[model samples]
Target chain A: MREVAALAGVSVKTVSRVVNQEAGVSSAVRERVSSAVSRLDYRPNLAASNLRRAGARTGLIGALVQDLSNSFSAGVLRALEDTARAHRTGVLATSLDEGVERERELVHDLVTRRVDGLVIMPASTRHDYLVSELRTGTPAVFVDRPPRGVDADSVVVDNASGARSGTEHLLARGHRRIAGLFHLTQIVTVQHRIDGFRSAHEAFGLVPDPRLVVTDISSAEEATRVVDRLLALDDPPTAIFAARNLLATGAVRSLAQHGLRRSVALVGFDDFPLADLLDPPLTVVRQDVARIGRTVGELIFQRIDGDTSPPRHVVIEPTLVVRGSGEIRPTA
Target chain B: MREVAALAGVSVKTVSRVVNQEAGVSSAVRERVSSAVSRLDYRPNLAASNLRRAGARTGLIGALVQDLSNSFSAGVLRALEDTARAHRTGVLATSLDEGVERERELVHDLVTRRVDGLVIMPASTRHDYLVSELRTGTPAVFVDRPPRGVDADSVVVDNASGARSGTEHLLARGHRRIAGLFHLTQIVTVQHRIDGFRSAHEAFGLVPDPRLVVTDISSAEEATRVVDRLLALDDPPTAIFAARNLLATGAVRSLAQHGLRRSVALVGFDDFPLADLLDPPLTVVRQDVARIGRTVGELIFQRIDGDTSPPRHVVIEPTLVVRGSGEIRPTA
Candidate 1:
């Protein structure tokens, strides 16, 4: 690298800039560096070992999703890994487990191991923790959720719009008494989805009963209990909108136990495995996970290849799948 | 390392073993090596460099499974990763899509990168290709299947016995005409399951109709088609045994479409997510994935820590879960 720098009549910093494909380098200067690099056959190691310095790549990508075991996250991971595999890069997979500290720790671990870049589904409400790594020129793309307190590339679904479509689907079916089951987590996605649900009711010139909106539904068991309580109310809802996958499953179980699976209408927010094979099947807001994952890979690789443009936040559209359950009549 | 070896009055090889905590070293020698290591404050770069000698540890573990998106494989990976995380180690995950060349290529890549250990769910019919890595002192543990052509640590469920149990469950219900649907791929586990299916019929002093046994059944769609064909036969099986999870899913869909879900008895080899949510529910032989994963982790880590004992093959027991589907009496 020093020889190349001297041969090109440039400083080591200039050589690094050219080698890393950093933006803002002059074309003429780049040509000179390219000539020197070709003449000397210099391999720049982006990751800091002397022998590895010959290549500008580390051949490793870090994937920090919330949970790799979950179907949604797992599908996205499969896409990312397949894409990376075609390019001959290995992925370091981690489960964030909804712990901010754990996410930060794993990220730090991957960074210290000198992975070329990262794909993250951040657990923290704020991403100020990532500023240092980004400044150090590490490439990253956030998936599932947008980053807060820091600028970065992101690929996410239009949660609010998707939720609004689902809610309106029920409203159009003549279900005036609709109940909502939602997660109480601080995740920004929940808020966006709730907003869409309210907006759907507002558009129809109706008010959603505050008491019908149940929060703090975490696990499938909890979702089942929440639905059970809703049904036990004096004026039970004619339809229910489950805001998450597990919640929908729990609702299914509860409905089955109460012999309401065929009577009460239900629409879920996310598509899950075998959702189409259920007795009445399940209607859901389906996001193209593979497309989202691919887009995320593209952005992260672009940054790795030295595109220092403004950060991109790509919002993918979600479509409503109207299977039997969601299309059920109010049956008043 | 040289200084530590000299101070401990041992060879550099002994120093390496002591530092890596390999077994078979005398306690006195281990104590001396520890004291010498403390005195020198040695930090062994398990992963070698141009500066590092060849055959050093990379402190990374490679996990190659069939499909990480599938629930069974995903569950195993989650458990393995959780175990690795506690030890401050990272995991490199790969999905082997039934391509032998792909599996070999990935193993080569990981070996070249000098990962310290590996956990593989082989896609190849034989694993003789892994001989070189095992010979080079790299720790490996095979999951879901035992390694062939070369010896290595492994943790697998008893597929044959599990299948036998599921088959007998249906036979006990007086279903003489039982159909079999299994993966076409020559996965050893699947072969064992087929053997068990044949064994069950033999035990009952009856011969299985060759026409009723379908092979090369790959996906859920294929399973459904196979079941539909069976039902259309002149003497359709009164009970069906699908030997895989996806196969079970397809069978359920086919039965529902033909309106035979309640009438025709069904028992599957593997349990899947939401099996209980099906109308009559699904009965299956369930493998303890968490235990398999944990066992694989233990064996691999043991090898990494210098326990060069004979390759230990651990066989986990599978249990038969009786839901409604398996207990149904044959109609007509």
Candidate 2:
């Protein structure tokens, strides 16, 4: 502190004020002090200071999601940020990219930085690894997926019910031959959605063709290829149920190329931007993403505010949006 | 360490290995130790430890963008994350939402947390405030925009040229009256794009009507409203040049609603996901977002690795993607 004050030609009190980000210091003086502090590589031991000040917080939260590039994850993050900012807190967000090891690593990193709380959309099947962190009083709220092996506050869309409704919509339109395009089956949400797809078919005393049910469709391009192959089959599906946004996008592309967009009925699980503006207009089972994000934010903040209540599990219901694509009747 | 070992019934060496994330510790043992550490609130002073070891890093970087929900910013963040992971680093990503004060505050927050480097798409018009941080040896790379009032590594798309090309394309299609839907003029890129729009008109000895060139459109819905109002005029535009993705989306919606989708030509500045799949397809001036991200990542990493060379400014040229929309002929 003395060195910074001396170098900046300011009083030690002024330097302290600048360093503490307190008001009443001129911009020039603050800049000078900051420059001096930087040149000397002087970092105040914030952790030590926070420890000394009772109830002092780092005012930083950690958020780990599946992918930052995906609209679903991005929307969740944005909402969390909005909530955090209201409390004068900052969020440290990172993507796990479906890597369990990466999730653990990032959780560890964030904890080391002494973040006040955590909001995680786990890539791991079991969150037994987080047991230690939770025990240490690091409040956590899971989003998009529920936590397994450890109890935690969670906000998730009713994937199975949503998928069932979308599938049932096509089935109600008299389409028995429907193709199911899905993401990785290992994901709990995906498995639930698959179950819903099966249950919807069972309601009509029918079963989905095993050949038409494709899993592990990772990218839009891959989904397009899968749909193209399905179309080439001896018995092409008359309707398609895409379990994810990218999968739906691929299906749209393939259907467009095959010139069967108007003929084949399609219902996607998740709604995306401009879904209603497409040629035939896409029908989807739309998750209330904003509400989900807001719910997760509120839950996480509540936990951080020392709520010792039992873990709350929230399931937001999705609604099926009817448009031109899903309303298409089977030509066959 | 002693208390943690005693609580977990593990040797000090075992606890050390677990804490350092070194190999050879059993999962059960590691879990026990971690739990004990959490219960005891035993935090290893990583900052002190890092200081003891030469060239030690916290293995974290900070990224601040305008909006994470926007595809452009999200895509850049994802690419940066990919590159960061290759070097076994975690990125702490945040959204500024075009708030200048928020940018300064987050930068201060990240600095206090001791991030090794920064990737910023600044919301501030001038970054003279970052001088002290730079002097303190924080490597930063500006993305999507250039740094003002301070010299730093920057990677930006050629906004003017891209906009010029798009406007010229519409002009070449014999559209004399073209409406320009733009974002906030305060943004440097927006200003550059507006200049390009004017220059394109000038090439044909024409000047755009100030009434047709609308600015300060903050949302797609707003753009739609603006386009609708413009369409109701006696001298309606035959073509539309949207300066951003969201603005273009708004124009597309309004055009569709007005039953003029095929009649009015439209070209957007930034290409978005599913642009090719839209009705009549969206023509755009596409920026190589991945490449820009990679370049920023490379430059920041190089600086972190002690590269003290003069700050490099890399401007990536945007490409005009001629699709169905931009090729539409004017009927007026």
Candidate 3:
């Protein structure tokens, strides 16, 4: 406050730096300001004061999440908060809702807030806005999915390899009929997972059954319908690879309804809540959500700190969590 | 922007108001400014322009959540987003991690950004900071729990009634032995829920058992240990109440480990994803997350519009969803 600065014999700007706990304020000046603050009982409106100073940041960061209900996004948001807190920044999160228009609107909203940087988990086909932001030197880091048709720093999981390995594990157990159940996101990550699934079949010299792959169904209700249709076929796949958590839940529900819990093998893409507590625990291709969050946080900060190198895409490895669902023996 | 204003023969403030869609500017003037913007190809940094105005807002609202990982928090946040989008305002979210100091810091952050208003889920034991903000006539609505030690507009669940009703459901089922589980937060909502649980026992001519209550344990690992201790007791309760979703998961894990799924009836506070898909399906008290979010959003907007009436605390009723878990027929 002006009163504190007057008592401390420092500029209001200097008072602001000290109040915000920002670096570059001398210790002597900080001490004087503290004493002045105590003596005057000057409870400053710190943010308002910062706005009056030059180079004062809004202290807001934009986080673009795909779906808030998803456990993975929830975990990532938590991790991102932990990272953002250390830098004295706060997150403004938006759920993309799997719509490009919604994602664009949220991005526009963040930009209009003048957020110093962004951590976007994009679900859009065209990333022109991101490219333009990059050209204008807006600090940003794409997470979960990369910015297509643009060069930007990204933190992604090795979905293709994880899916491939999971399929191979099922095949190695002598099960040739494997199904791939995935969400209907247009992101490249989905394609990679599908690629991995197909590559596994290729490695085993088995022809891929196109009917076993399900896509474009958003909600659990639709997923249930799709899985039911797939299973009603004369020869349903013995093992199912659910590409996402929601799809996996739908498949599990169908399995339970059909009274085939132990008979049909399943390996889900993302982990879900209470997966381990089920009668036959779910096996999932587990992506290290916390690590991915941390890495993306680190990458964004690095980019913000004048890292002028080409945009880097960092891929984290996923592990196969072998549980009862993936190891079920097929009935002849 | 100055050039456009000069060309249009208008003040910079008038030009800004016209350009940014703020009220008070005439339609003719707005059209003139729009034409000038088109002619000059002058794009305004909407976020900065809104801030530069004296009384106009940046079309942004801040939401402070206690924890994003919690299902309750996430559900509320998603609903808030939907409401905000409908109102054409962008939401800036921050996670407080249930720390008073952190909540204080985030409030300051939003204030500095000059967010039009705030929808805060306060974590502080006292609401001195919020009181100060309210004194300054800053529009804010507290959600999930009322602001402690401060009078303000709030949207909260009837935790006591919900818990009491839940306990009564168990009591009516001929089970004298029942245990209560709750997260440890100095929050009044938690206490209210605990009170209701106690009230149920008191009504049934039974004394509250100290050994049957667990508090100060929130994390899954901690809950796991607490549930283990509860189950190992010489006279373990026939029914158990886990306060929140994570605790429910922990209790389920503990139950599964002991192979006592159907033997002991369980009820959880919050409904979670795939609660019904489980082997026995979970019984839970479901909070109206969407209704709560909408009410909080409306309250914040009302406050922003200068609603200075006596503070109102709106309590939404929660519903008890009886699934297979609580409906199990106890065989003595």
* Most accurate candidate by DockQ: 2
User: Candidate 1: where is the Cα deviation over 4 Å?
Assistant: A1-55, B1-57
> What ranges in model 2 sit over 4 Å off?
A4-48, A51-56, B4-56
The residue pairs that clash in candidate 2, if any, are none
Which wins on DockQ, candidate 2 or candidate 3?
2
DockQ of each: 0.25, 0.47, 0.45
Cα lDDT tens digits for candidate 2, A210-259: 99999999899999999999999998999999999999999999999999
Q: What is the interface RMSD of each candidate, in Å?
A: 6.3, 2.8, 3.3
Q: Which candidate is the best by lDDT?
A: 2
Give fnat of each prediction, in order: 0.49, 0.53, 0.53
For each candidate in turn, the TM-score is: 0.85, 0.89, 0.89
DockQ, candidate 1, vs. native dimer: 0.25
Per-residue lDDT of B78-186 in model 3, one digit per residue for the tens? 8888878777777877787778897887776676566778888987878875666555456888898887777778899999998998888888897778888888748
Predictions in order: lDDT: 0.86, 0.89, 0.81
Q: What is the DockQ ranking, best to worst? A: 2, 3, 1
lDDT of 1 at A137: 60
Greater TM-score among 1 and 2 belongs to 2
User: Residue by residue across A165-192, what tens digits does model 3's lDDT show?
Assistant: 9888888877888888876647688888
